[model samples]
Target chain A: MADGTTTAELDAPGDLVSVADRLDGWLEELDEPETLVEGRREAWERYRELPMPQTASEEWRYTDVEDLRPEDFGFVEPEAARSVEIEDLPATVQEVLAGEQDRSGVAVQVDAGEVYRRLDPELEEQGVVFAPIVEVARERPELLEDRLFSSEVTDAEEKFWTLHRAIFSGGYLLYVPENVRVPEPVHAFRYLEREDAIVGSHTLVVAERGAEVTCVEEFLSPDLEETSLSVGGVEVFAGENATVRYISLQRYGRGVEHYSVQHATTGKDSHLSGFNVALGSDRHRADVTSHVEGPGSESEMLALWFGDGDQHIDHHTLQYHKAPHAYSDLLYKGALTDRGRSVFRGVIRVAQEAQLTDAYQTNRNLLLSEDSHANALPNLEIEADDVRCSHGATVGQVDESQLFYLKSRGLTPLQAERLLVFGFFEEVLGRVPVEGVRSRVRSAIERKLGF
Target chain B: MADKLLEVRDLHVTVEDEDIEILKGVDLEVDHGEIHALMGPNGSGKSTLAKLISGHPSFIASRGEVLYEGDDVLEMEPDERARAGVFMAFQYPSEIPGVSISNFLRTAINAGRDEEDEISVFDFRKRLKDALELLDMDESFADRYVNDGFSGGEKKRNEILQMAVLQPTLALLDETDSGLDIDALKVVADGVNRIGDQNQDLGVLLITHYQRILNYIEPDRVHVMIDGKIVESGGPELAEQLEEQGYDWLREEKEPVSA
Candidate 1:
């Protein structure tokens, strides 16, 4: 992706420059495999060569990063994390865990440190691996050497993507073997408590043929007085006949800026479903994509965001159907109140070889206040003549009729509005297969709605 | 002493943003435990009166008074009026996607009660179960979103279900029998009758364009409204007369009655 885009136009931000200079120190602290060490070095070099994304670029038309003062955030120093019990985790994390007890495993990352991780013995005994990515690299480097830095992981050429690659800590890895179906979902909680700290985390899931698994990851932090930053990446691989469901809940507190790039590729007859809930963060940009690589593969992408305060949430999604007879559907819904703003752009690309592909994309936004705003842009680029592809986008205010109906049933105006917003997101929430994830997402939305 | 369960005294209502009046000084009264059928032709201001009583913002009560148990009902917000035991069964109920009927009913029940008196989940489930059974609706109906994608019959039955569960002292049935098949109309009517029978003090104002529904759920008195005013009031015989002759006679009579 180094297509001669010169970085000479501008100097790197001081905050990110400081982080880049500490890469050697980060590498020294984590005794990792040679392959990963080389990967980090390459990523850091690319980070230096790439330029910060500008709003002038089409991909960032709605989000402006020039106002970001990342220097206000201090880099989290790497230290040996003291292992703690599940009970010792933060109260918020405990509350999340309390809602779901039928998990195959749970991992907690605090301030870019793995504090607690557990995998059911039965699954572990069956060669299923759920652990920190660094540990997995050190123990079984072969498992990641070919897949970690592969093109399937991230096609993004953005500087944040490279920055995340170079500095990510306490990364998560979930690998299921062939023909093994994990009955319960494995959960991960990434919590940041230190004020004004820059942190990065990476999550990778690989399912072999006929394997089935569900993973739920949440990013959480307490509201901070100063600005903080997070650059994260997520990659998923569903093998032949495999099924994988990933639910990501982003609940970073106010004064936090987050950038994450997520990509998934499906195998023959496999299904990959992803649900993203963005409720917090002062400024967040999420780029998600589903690549249907094999015939008969199915990809379902869903996201719901509730923004309030001065939050600015931007989401861009792509459904790329590269193989014939593949099916992909995307649904994104959001609600904004106060001075909150949201931007959603989605594209469905059907390649020439993807004949008979069935693809649909929809984005709906409910602006709850006059000051709140939402922009939705849905596009389609289809090269296959026989494929069926359609896209739709809508931006609307709360329906007075709906509100009146609820109010007439005895609910107050506030309660009625909240219920309407919740119901607006119900289309996506109802499809979330994981009960625990669904409940947690609902609670996060309630929290945003001040319930 | 409380004057009546509901008393509309020379009520004048107007459509918002329009100079034309929808209800011109109409007066009516319903006593406790009485079922009064309000019969009118389309666009004769029958629904307007019901909406004004329920505090629908689309219609303005430009003048006059709506008293509930001798208290000013128009002064209350829609929700407050609901908590005060005034309910309206709409002709075309608004469909609330994604909210289950059971959930909406529970929230409505809770909204009517004090915090300390919130209904328990078990009790709510039982109440919903009973209401559904009384409406002859499948148990799964409670799990579906409120009136979403429901057939006309189902929507009317749902309104009756809500009426049964809420047990309001006063119910304004706005053309509840308009879009129902015979069997569905019977089920919905039976639901209303059962609830009315259970609550002896329940006062119902059944608004309908046709008198077919009165066959199943009888009304103590029937009032014919023409041109936004009650032209006549009598017993069940009034409904039978309107059914045989239609509303043209009443529209022509235009004789104001002491309702």
Candidate 2:
């Protein structure tokens, strides 16, 4: 609308008008460095050029998004900088923050701008950069452009990926220098409060060689009156011998539709662990990948989701083993009730040079209602002969015998089911090393169970 | 209240999904503080009767009345029966992974009591410790998942431990001696006797194929079940007679009567 658009691009079609039409306006108000703007412009071009995902594609066979009308959701322009204290935040956001009292830093974002950001002075003095990406890009744009625009780190070529890159806002950048180990986790909270708004946020973590850090990202929103969209991205770079742990809890309201792409690449001898707990949103599709690119690297991916009230959730995971002597393990579990459904597609791909690559993947789903459904698809593509790779999947209902056994002990039906559900997820929950994060996840599960 | 702690009168049952009958007009009674041993070979519906009294969903009572303390037990659910102080030590207990025994037992105890009378953690721990010691179990056993990866002997011991903690008014031991060795059987029988002694009004229906368990836990009455019906009821000697005669003489005596 500002006269810089070419006639040919403007004439594209009605389908691209909603999100694409607002890109230029959002970019103008984004307030970033020139280099970052240029990168976003290129991403916008690619976003317009790529076609929308279709169910005919193998990647989306079980999840259909044709009914989504992007035009119905409007993008919010960047909000003016305002001083927002922790007490002024929503109760839901405050409750989550209170769960992790030992966090070294915390950032809270609402809609299109960050509301509050804080970091421990000691960590900042140690040359660690933990702040909003927009603020950091204003000072050193190169630091962000290099990672944001890197194809090797974010290989997702979907339309949503391009859209997120073009207009991601309110994300945090965590940078730990070599040999620095942060004792406490850094927390990032993203919340959506506006109705019929499309919110896109990003998270970037760079743990340099010999560094160790743990970061937890929590997403939550109040039950909105109208449906909205959330497109998110997370990129992690674990350098040689560095140890990084990233945990994300998605607890959006039922009126929200979410699409997230999470990618992590590990260097030699680096250890990376990612845990995702998704229990919100009316519809959500998450693509989580762990790229083991260096020898002696280890990656652990764990996720759990609970769906109720006709919610539809889908997850696709990739364990890409490109170096020898790398180990990757993934375990994803989900539960559904009240006609809710879930889809899981996992791939363990070992490259030819990746000998001695040990990869294991397991997906289990518990159906609590007869009408609830789940589909699990696990695949292995190993070009290396010496690699040890295995995958397993199971979709089962709550065992009546187990329920009876618990009930015979005098537990009420609801209590029995709750205990069994927690029991089913205990294996993964116990694996979470952080006490604060584990308890927060446990409380979230209790909330989902309507306790 | 009823004179008998448990009264099963002319009870008949069949598998819920199958047409075959399991319990054919079974009749039995156990007074307060009495131990009645129901003996029969495999497939004599010994377990079915216990399961039916416990309200297992698989077995539906076609015609009968199961009265516990003058209340119709057939009208209640399994959980309701459990809350009413009726307990059954399963022949093969279900394994519930990831649920610790301590947590499960605490939840069960709290569920069976009134909301305001819920047991505190300290009290529950003390009771669990006492029960474990009574069964000669180590403290670590309570930390393990409920019956998961437990040996057969351990499973039986856990059942007895649960019985000790719950302290039910009526207890049904369904083939509790089947999978136990001589030592395990002795430990389990000793546990039952100790619990019975502690709860003076406790009534037990001990179902077993062999009379070996009767040696430790004396029985006031022994009922012989052959082909879904109790053929004879006598004192503890009936158990030894069936154990020695191998249920054949009873079967032969019944063959002429049926013909």
Candidate 3:
């Protein structure tokens, strides 16, 4: 409770510190887990002590985070009537949701900081806790005490994480007991819909030893004309020999700003794989960090993005090997057209204790138009004597010979170029193990290409 | 000679971006049902001649008139030339990923077919099967990406498969046997031979630097090209002669000494 209180106080807005006080008062009304309260408070204090990240920070170099001022956006609760109306779902998202038939697991919908839907009775009976962050704090304090904000592996890298910790209002939390495997994917969707609306959603997933689960978090909007901001953080903990797959698809409409931090910690012999497909947003930035802390662990990160018409997609990735005999492989591919731009900065760091680590990082870009731009910076920092680490970045255009060959075979130039671009994206899109997600991503890419 | 399938007169061409002319002045004529083998050294403009006749945009035809069945081909686009019965098997084929061989071959065939005609999937499959069988290629090859991960012999064989499907009037085999081993070369040669026999009206222009392919599909006329001009014209015996004497002896002789 002390740590949670401190965190709330530290996160209190300067002019509107009373907002934090009011939030704390609201949190006290719920039945929260004691341990979670302490953990949240400690995270709050730590966040208050940390300074805002500037361009000097290696992770913040390419991304413009200075424009993200807390004073510019204030917390505003979503309208209850519109929040509960399912018919307001965007046409694209409605189409996807209507097509989905397998709804066996938990289904959650969060508008702003309010939870509109939750269906997880069987999970509750199996000792699996699936609830909103505030409820998780009130009900399972012990779980939050040690695991809530205690996973500090990615705290030092970005200023947004601290802000997320300080101001996060509500998010989804899931915990599966040891050896428990959820057959269906847990689905959560977040909606940011309003002018200057700011949302801080926190997602914490912990899979006990030998547990298996799949989680999908989707970010979207109801209207393209609204100016909105979203800062999200996701932390995944995989216990010994556990298997976890986390996928995040961000498709915010035009004029929306998004920033996200995703971190995964793997235990001995554990496996964690993540896929991110970013499509929409006027300005979007993401930091994905994977920490391999135990031997025999492996992590795979895959991402695909298509930027068109003044959109900017910036991604920073960190593959940290903290223990020996661990491995990580990351592959990111993107295509830019119609004056769009993208920047990818990836780092593979092998710590002193992480000997015999095998890590590889690669980023590839295809520039379809002359005005489209792509900048890639791949780096490596190795302190271990016995390790294999390599990084590469490539930027190229459609091969003229390939175009001629396809055209010679009766395909128009545009058709041929489309096929080649699809082939270039197949390397990353093929790795998405989920069929529905893959199809959705493909459809989004096609829409972006105006197909 | 009156049923000439291809007629080129005083053709002059140069490589793009350079004043160095490759095809200085060349004249040749090939009637229907004739396989003309053009043998030349590396820089004698054998490939440039093929491009000029096939309407390749990179080669500048300074002075030449290519008439295919009395239609001037210089005004046609590359694809138009292809549809108008000019087929050229590239010396080095480009690899196209994500486009399957069946799709590519079907598109090419449909493009060349009658405008009112449409190929159903069933008919396309049957045609593909028959073509693959004629080429002795595996059925799985049709489903693979076009020329992607294909071996040199497989690429050349795939080219011939295309030729068999499209059934072009004039087929230009440009160095198709360059990288193939003995077995692969035999397979490619046999495929070409089958296509030639099936389409008697097909005028074949076999461009190669080696005489091995001539052993399989005997050419009716062998034209020795030197400095972009046909210097010697004779039967297949000229190919055997050139194979033995090399181009050095022919390089020294300035005039067209009858073979």
Model 3 misses residue B13 by how many Å?
2.5
Q: How high is the CA lDDT of each candidate model? A: 0.85, 0.86, 0.78
- Please give the distance, in angstroms, between residue A355's alpha carbon in candidate 1 and its true position after superposition: 0.8
Judge candidate 1 against the unseen true structure and give its global Cα lDDT, from 0 to 1: 0.85
DockQ of 1: 0.76
Compared with the true structure, what per-residue lDDT tens digits does model 2 show for residues B1-259? 4567888899999999899998889999899999999988899999999999988899999998989998899999899999889999998999988789999999999886777899988999999999999988999999999999999889999999999888799999988998889998898999999999999999999998888899999999999999999999999888888777788898888878654
Clashing pairs in 1: none
Give per-residue CA lDDT, model 1, range A1-451, as digits (tens).
0112222211112333346456667677657777777788888787777656677877777888755544334667544444666566788899888876899988878876777777888998898998777778878877786577564433343577777777788877899999998999898888877665688889999999999999988999888787778888998999999999999899888878888889899999999999988988898889998989989999999999988889899999989889999999999999999999999988899999999999999999999889999989899998999988888999999888888878888999988887887778888999999877777778878877787
Q: After superposition, how far is residue A126 of candidate 3 from its true place, in Å?
A: 5.6
Which parts of model 2 are misplaced by more than 4 Å?
A: A1-19, A25-30, A67-72, A79-82, A140-146, A151-157, B112-114, B257-259
Q: Candidate 2 — which pairs collide? A: none
Docking class of 3: acceptable
- Which tens-of-lDDT digit does each residue in A1-451 have in candidate 2? 0112112210111222355467787677656777777778887787667666778887888888766655346766655334466776668888877665788888877787776777888998998988777777877666676686463433333677877877777787899999999889888888887777787888999999999999988889988778888989899999999999999888888899899998899999999999988888899899998989979999999999999998999999999999999999999999998889999999999999999999999999999888999999999999999988999999998889989888887888888999999899987888887887777777877887888
lDDT score for residue A220 of model 2? 90
For model 3, how does the per-residue alpha-carbon lDDT over A1-451 read when each residue is reduced to its tens digit? 0001111111112332232344455345434455544444555566556666676766666666655554356554322211233444445555666767564343334445443444456765777777666666666656655666555555445456765665576676788889988777777777665555567788888999999888888887754465667878999999999999999988877878888888899999999999888898888888899999979999999999999999889998999999999989999999999988999999899999999999999999999999999989999999999998889999999997777666554555565677788777878877786777888887887787667
